[model samples]
Target: MHIFYTPDITQGTYTLSEEESKHCVRVLRLGVGAVVNLVDGKGGFYTAEITSDNPKKVGLLITDVKLEFHKRNHHLHIAVAPTKNIDRIEWFLEKATELGIDEITPIITDRSERKVVKDDRLNKVITSAVKQSIKAYHPKLNEAISYHAFMNLAFEGDKLIAHCIDGDEKSYITDLVQPQQKYLILIGPEGDFTPDEVNLALNKGFKPLTLGDNRLRTETAALAVCFEINYLNR
Candidate 1:
């Protein structure tokens, strides 16, 4: 099925934006009476038939509508420091969306190599991932914020920090996470979290967990946590 994204739908018809219209009419050659699917990226999927095949503003007559519920009862939020290699972080976003993540936060830690990210570029990656995976909901991409600032925000779920530090009470992430509960996992940068940062997270009720014996890059750890959550729930 050919799917397009439009956040706004009104009355019994939907209009595709200029870019989408061009793709539908000029590129895809979808003409009037042809059937196509659309998603608002807000859990609503619409099945419509083309009314006018105008390449600039294609119009569609809505035929069917479906509302999708969250696949998993739990919400998975992963906040991690942006890696120096931007491609790796983008790859993580793609995989995490396919694995079913609710939200992602780019955090700035003391040892972080990259500080700023282009939101538009990152959002496109997310949108493409959602379409490729045929998912109705789009994971939220939060703006970059400092480690301390992120800690101050209220979290209404299980919060854990994945660090490489050796300690007596370290537990594997698979064991620490509970099923069917909202979860947030924080990952550090290449240099990892500083001593003070770890202490702050611990004091804020964030459990320190390990991914495994082998050390992982920032993006790898983030995706690993996402997979573990889905594995346990499945």
Candidate 2:
């Protein structure tokens, strides 16, 4: 079934946007009476049939609505430094959405190679990922913030910081991620977090953790932790 995202689907709202309408009516050649699935990205999944194929606005008559769709047990928020290559960061966002995440924030550490990101573009990537994965919920993409500014946000759950520096002080990420609880993790850039930055995070209450023995790229490390969190959820 073709799935379309319509976040504004509510009482008396059944029209697809101009862009989605063109894709459905023209590209897909779907017409009246065509069955379609729609997601509101806030846990509302609907099965609807097209009533009008106006190429500019495909109308719908909702057949069924499933609220609280695909609810997960925990919330995983991974704050990662944007990679120097924008594609790499985008890849992380796409994969993380498929794997399941509650939120993502771009954290600018002292060694971060990239500092700026377009939240609008990243959000589109998130929505596309959700549609491709057939998920009802879209992970929140927070604005980029400095490391210190990020620490100021109040979060309660397992707090962890994954870094390259290895020692008895660092625990494995898998061991630290608690089940059925909200989690916030920080993944630094390619150069990794400066010692002072790690210390500051620790002082601010983020626990030190490691992904594994081999050093990984920024995107690779972020994905590793994301996979680990999903595993823990399961």
Q: Which numbered prediction scores highest in TM-score against the true structure?
A: 2
**Residues 51-75 of candidate 2: C-alpha lDDT, one tens digit per residue:** 9999999999998999989999899
How much lDDT does each candidate structure score? 0.89, 0.89
Weakest 10 consecutive residues, lDDT, candidate 2? 165-174
User: Candidates' TM-scores?
Assistant: 0.96, 0.97
lDDT of 1 by residue, 192-230 (tens): 999899999999999988887888989999999999998
Pairs in steric clash, model 1 = none
Candidate 2 displacement at residue 60 in angstroms: 0.6
RMSD in Å for all candidates: 1.3, 1.2
